[model samples]
Target chain A: MTMAQMDRLLFGDNQFFGINHMSEEKARAQAMRFQKTDAIMEVLDVAYAEGIRTFMCTTHDRITEVADRVRADPVRYADFRFYPCMPYAHKYANAVTDHGMVGALRHFMPSDGVLSTALTGGRALATKEVDGIAKVLIDMEMKMFHGLQTPVIFVQNVFTDLLLGMGFTRALRIFHDHVVTKYGVEPAFITMNMPMLLEALEKEGIERPIICANINKIGFRMSGGFDAYLDALRSGRVRAVAMSVYASGAIPPDEAIHWISELPGVESIVFGASSAGNIRGTKALVDKYMGAPA
Target chain B: MDHKVRIGVVGLGKMGLSHFAMVNAHPQVETIACDGAGFMVDVLGRNLENTIYRDYDTMLDAERLDAVVIATPSRLHAPMTTAALERGLHVFCEKPFCLDWADSERLATLAADKARVAQVGYHYRYVGAFREMKRILDTGALGRITHVLAEAYGPVVLRPKRSTWRSQKSEGGGCLYDYAAHPVNLLNWFFGTPAQASGSVLTPIFSDGIDDQVTATLGWDEGPTAQLSVNWSDESHRKMTTRITMIGTNGRIFADRQECQVYLRAPDPALPGFEAGWTVKYTTELTEDPWFYLRGEEYSAQLADFSGAVAEGQGKAVENDFASAAQTDRTMAMMIENAETGQPVGAPPVTARPTPARKRGWFAWKA
Candidate 1:
């Protein structure tokens, strides 16, 4: 995925779902505030009005309602497209708990891959076919975004790091191939440990894999440290999407944007905001620093 | 009649040997030992009168063990625990429970089904200073805690060493999982599950792929916000230095290995002998020196708890059970996710407090 194709400022869904890393009180309040789809839409509308057309969001259960609402009012969301991140693992875990494993798999199996996926899932579970299980699961996760424009599909960090730790590089290839072949979208892996993940993906014969990781000053949560990340960016060995630009409320906004703008390979910064003012403020800062078009 | 719990110790590494010594010292326990390293197994065989085997499975097959303590590298934790649990043996495995949350969850389920006294080795919880802190918090003297800060720093892995499993990420290397687990588990123990978290993992100060430092913020839906900062690269300290500070509406409590300090804004009857201002209590003041305080009291305390639970036959909920360890795993996962995604990864809130019933009209206050 190239910088031009992805909007410099991509809106994220954590704020709407009541996720605030710095303060649980605020997170709970926001979650209560946006419990309804309309409340989420109102915030999304504010972001949309402020010129953020790309919504980079997890495949949260509530997000489907937002997607349906957006789809219904095409005129309002005419330019909106999704950057769907997948394997909302908690959803799957809960599904498995409520239903049996096979029943959960059936519940999420796409219409196109129902039979094949079911057979593959069963065989994979029984025989420990890692690639087969991964392929079916990715397809199942993409079912919610069937009619949407998903130019980039992310493997959320939870699953991505798990694969990295297990050294299951083949699963990365499977995700890449299936996303490209079936959805015709670029595959991106989100990981807390970026340098190691980048090397892992490259080892799997994936050249310049799109990786999203924590990149900020203070090296806040950047694994391998900030200098290593800077070296990787300067080397141009991979495509990078910078998240946690604010260091989860640590760095000031202007300094965050200014520091990130000077970085070599970061193509986009994903951020979440609960109010219109914060949304517009962040957008203005990105436009100022990154020269993102209004 | 001999009623001592028959136990096996696996992976005679630093922790394994320590646990073996503790188990041997316990009057209520008899121990067998195993290690992949033949020399370590031989040494253990010579040192202890207990049986010794090079392979863990062979020991399990040959010996009748009531319980087992696994001190293997993190990658082996899940498999070893599962194998022991399958054989109907209670287990006390070392920290980071498993490298992956999926494996941890699976083992948790198995342990639950088998009704085994499974516990993760988070020895810091058994420290006297922290136990006193827990006692204070449990008394509600802290009064609606608002924030908790946990810091652990040391020079454990200060230089580049030969590639061991601890230096490899796939093998659960790094301070993030190993050293940071103490503070993370402590936070979970002190404030329950966080509603959300975000942080960064830093590495390569000493080794590659193994994270040497981690800084994270864990937020609860209502109670307290928590922050953790751990570094295994600090060269000033010879051993790990851990400190936790809890901020509450009425007071703040700070604790470490040696001492605990409490500052209260107002006097509460809940805390006897503690006045409205500041109070300092050392660990020496709190806990009596034990009979076999050789490898630290916390380690002995955890083993004693595990032994008691094993003796009980039914799985009793211990402080650091598989489920609690899994909660730490989930929090670590969220921290990693937040660090990578730059968004605060959300967790389910702690039990939601009931909204107070409001009386209607102007006479509500009077009523």
Candidate 2:
């Protein structure tokens, strides 16, 4: 069996969803700018043309349209892959409760594996609410990327940090096991505190697990401090994927990318930029600093 | 003080649960949970490996807690906080410290007398952009701020909804205490307690006997004037959007949760970050990453500060301390009185109060 190769540079979905950690003005403006799916696809196309094969994104509602377009036109995006992240958990449970299991499965599940997924729901429905909710979220969130290449699934920061804080790290293993067994894909964790998570994952018997976190020169959102991250990366115990490499535009492209390229174990960099010029410029920086993508 | 601060958390509403999660997770803290709601306590107890209590006083008595975090409804803050302080426990209470100004003043003095770490959850002070605003203002980059605009709008009550404690005048103090108090507290942090607050209006769009919108004017003796416009009913925004814009003689400074925009007519060598024209600095640039992040960095940051203050023991002044919150509470009281009497309250003479020696162009807002 062979594992899918992780792309060195991945385009991110934050720009499409108006998630600017820096500027609300820019977030709101870009949100309005990318209201239509075409605008998002156009940027994705630019990223794809510039040699970014992977799209790391949250399972937002609009992603269905993008998936449909990608699935519809396989020739244009021949090597396209998705790294789908989970969104709001409460919203998922609400959907299941409001629409009932079967009704929500209709709205949420893609046609290909609906039968088996819904059948598993019977056993899930018998479990406690918390366990049931997690199942519903994973199943529904993955439903959008039907018949697409999803090499990696991510547990969002909110869930990852909460579990990390609560010391319920056993759940991380459950997530990894479920994603691997069910989807036949690797599960990665996105967290603010990469050092803590690396320890947590290692304790859970997951070795060299891909963990993405805020890694930048200013150390903007890289929790557990820069020294800890440097130690973790230098030791090569975890498969590191650096996100927020630009620190949300705080650091310039050449400066941020060059700094990240020097890190020991970072295997990927994920970024979000709306404009084609930005996408091209950042891709050029990544290639220049870290060599061309595999 | 105990090496690991033993803490008890009371009231497990939304904010309470989150605070409990962070508190229970702290490395330097051993925390127990309490809530009046039996179901909440039971649920938390079943999942989390911690002692849970149904009564606040019972938890305080049973546990040798050095501190307590009060995240109850707004009405219960004053009593809960007072009880915790009386126990010689450091208290970190949720915002709108008290619905009434007198309670705020009383509690402020009580916390001072008791020598306990008293902090209110005005988490905005932890936000990076706002902190940048403070840093610039401290540098005297925006010289002699004259006029200001403070606004907060959110899509909270878009249509008529059933009233909960949140929508009630008595329990939550409606929009004035519950919603507008956020920006108002930020105003207090920027300027000293306003000498006068006037032209206050509290209007309801979707709730009865409570305000969903608030508008008012605040003034300081030094010269800076400010307007407060907040509406929770506005649907244009996705969430609560608080912004402050200051117009000064030297330049203008504007800040929100995400970014700070600074303008200087003639840039000084001392202020390297800002140019002669508009320079924008973002939250990403200003903030350090938290050891743990929940909701946003600010939420975890506030709890971490409270924990650190508790560990440091008495005389460790918190950033958003009870005294600082009392200033905001008093300002709200002035606005409420002005609204009732159709006249300005606490209006100082339209002239100079004897300027303090420290009141140079540097730290002008300190006065």
Candidate 3:
């Protein structure tokens, strides 16, 4: 299998979207401050300068603008990478943005009457059709990341768990296959329930997939409970990418990074920092805990 | 109560399946599902361990359910909820409780009369930022909120091609019921039922008969008034973006899903956690993670609250009861009735005034 080197520390885009789990005031301030694309790029450039290449981002509209700039200045961002998380709605479901059940259907429907088609046959999407639908949406979402080294791509937690719940793990298999075959990179899944997702993915014969979830000392948002996560990490069931490591700012950076660094199988830690100092500080912490990224 | 709470989820659509998963995983709950669609029933039946039913009536007849979660379209909500409630089963119906105001009011009364745990899925109420906002507002921190703006925007209808149940006015009631009700319900939650609604407008950006953009004003004679703006055709937003901005005598408050932004003249001890200048509260601190989280903390929290309410009996008050949803339904009905966009008051009969001859005009100018 061909996969890019997973960094000890990766940059994320939650700060750009004004998502703060810990401090709403700080999140609002960052959101207002990063209203302009240049502001986001400035912070991203800081991470890039500090040797943080991978940017884990959702496919929000503003990020498309950011992608345009990144695409234009190739030489400047030669080693720049994107670890895109998609369906934009997945990250924002906490808000009343889901537009209801039919609204979600519209997001992935290839043509109209997905309902009609589903009614006609119990096997709504055959292998080819599933491939077609999955590939079309994936390609469309991946358009902004074109020519950039998107070494890793993620299926957002909402879609991941939805598919998992409906016993449609096949869709995830399809997502994994498409992202791997077409993109030539790792296809990852982000979910709240780590153990359940691991079991579901393994059931689909997707062995040791790259899974990202909330991994903090407090077990904040770790759905299967923190002990289950520790066991999964201990067993090396999957290649873990630690996110929300600070539990949305609840955990101190030192304590947060220390816990993740001591975990057995966390391949990467994706974090968002506003300042050069913050980025460098996190990088230094990662270096201190896990040693510098080779 | 010792025995597991038996729940049957009706309508095997996106939300239905999500609710099933969340409820199915609950340690104290046993979830079954029913759908009219053969494909969905078959797909789920073959995959999941729980029983799947093809017909709603058949499922109700066959299974001994303690409650039913109705996630059907807007029109079906009334009938499905009525059926479930008639069975003396607690009902958790999805939003836009009933498209018909009278029906919604009737159902609310019936649910109360029956003393059943009747709830509506206005999940935003479970969001921590909004919950914290409510806490602060109740404390009179943003004293005497004068005007408020409630907005919900999304990229649902960029360039409409085929019509789904969502695009049909009779079915989903377009953006008003499918999208706008969420923020409108929040408005009702923050302030009581509006005294009046007016100047409502529904613009069909792409769809023919249904609204793609909805705008209106809701006024409370005794309290703050709110301006509602909702559009599903906006591509700028990846998904729906609902925000509430309140301006008051003391300070101002603005919040969405992520964070609550507040500005106060001075720190009020009632909301003593913050200082004077400006304070923001994020959902992370505001929200407590539920036992099982599927989509969002709010989704899981909403379901958790429902099951908890069901388990606790009628003594436990439901935060989002049928009566609150009835108020939202009434507000929605008022907006629909007030929406007089069909007759755009065209500039009253442009009559051409007689013009004087060029020579006479020139002579008059010279004089």
The candidate that wins on TM-score is: 2
Q: Which model is ahead, 2 or 3, in terms of TM-score?
A: 2
Highest DockQ scorer: 2
Give lDDT tens digits, candidate 3, residues A1-294: 486678888898888886665554566688889999999999998888888888899888788998999999999999888889887764334222333433443454555645435423535444455446557777878888888888889988877887776567877888889887887899999988888889989989999989998888988888877888999999978899988888766788998898888888898898888888889989999989998654
lDDT of 2 by residue, A148-172 (tens): 9998999988888777776667667
Cα lDDT of candidate 2 equals 0.82
**Candidate 2 on B150-262: residue-level lDDT in tens?**
99998777767654677777886578887789899988998879988889998888787888899999998876889999998887676689999999877999999988999
Inter-residue clash pairs, candidate 3: A22-A248, A24-B281, A24-B282, A25-B280
Candidate 3 lDDT, tens digit per residue, B1-367? 7889999998877578788888887878988888887444655565567888878899999999999999887789999899998999999998878888899889888888888888999999998889988888999977678889999998777775465577688886688998999999999999878877776898898888999999987777557768999999886664567889999878999888888989998888898877777887777777777777886799888888889988878523368999999989888877887786443221222223334556667667787
Candidate 1 chain A least-lDDT 10 residues:
A121-130
Q: What ranking of all candidate models by lDDT puts the best one first? A: 2, 3, 1
Off by over 4 Å in 2: A89-129, A288-294, B38-43, B138-141, B266-276, B352-367
Winner on DockQ between 1 and 3 is: 3
Q: Which stretches of candidate 1 lie above 4 Å from their native place?
A: A1-294, B347-367
For all candidates, state DockQ relative to the true structure.
Answer: 0.01, 0.36, 0.28
Each model's total of backbone clashes? 2, 0, 4
Report the candidate with higher DockQ, 1 versus 2: 2
Worst 10 residues of 1 chain B by lDDT: B38-47
Q: Would you list the clashing residue pairs of candidate 2?
A: none
- Rank candidates by TM-score, best first: 2, 3, 1
* Model 3: residue A92 alpha-carbon error in angstroms: 16
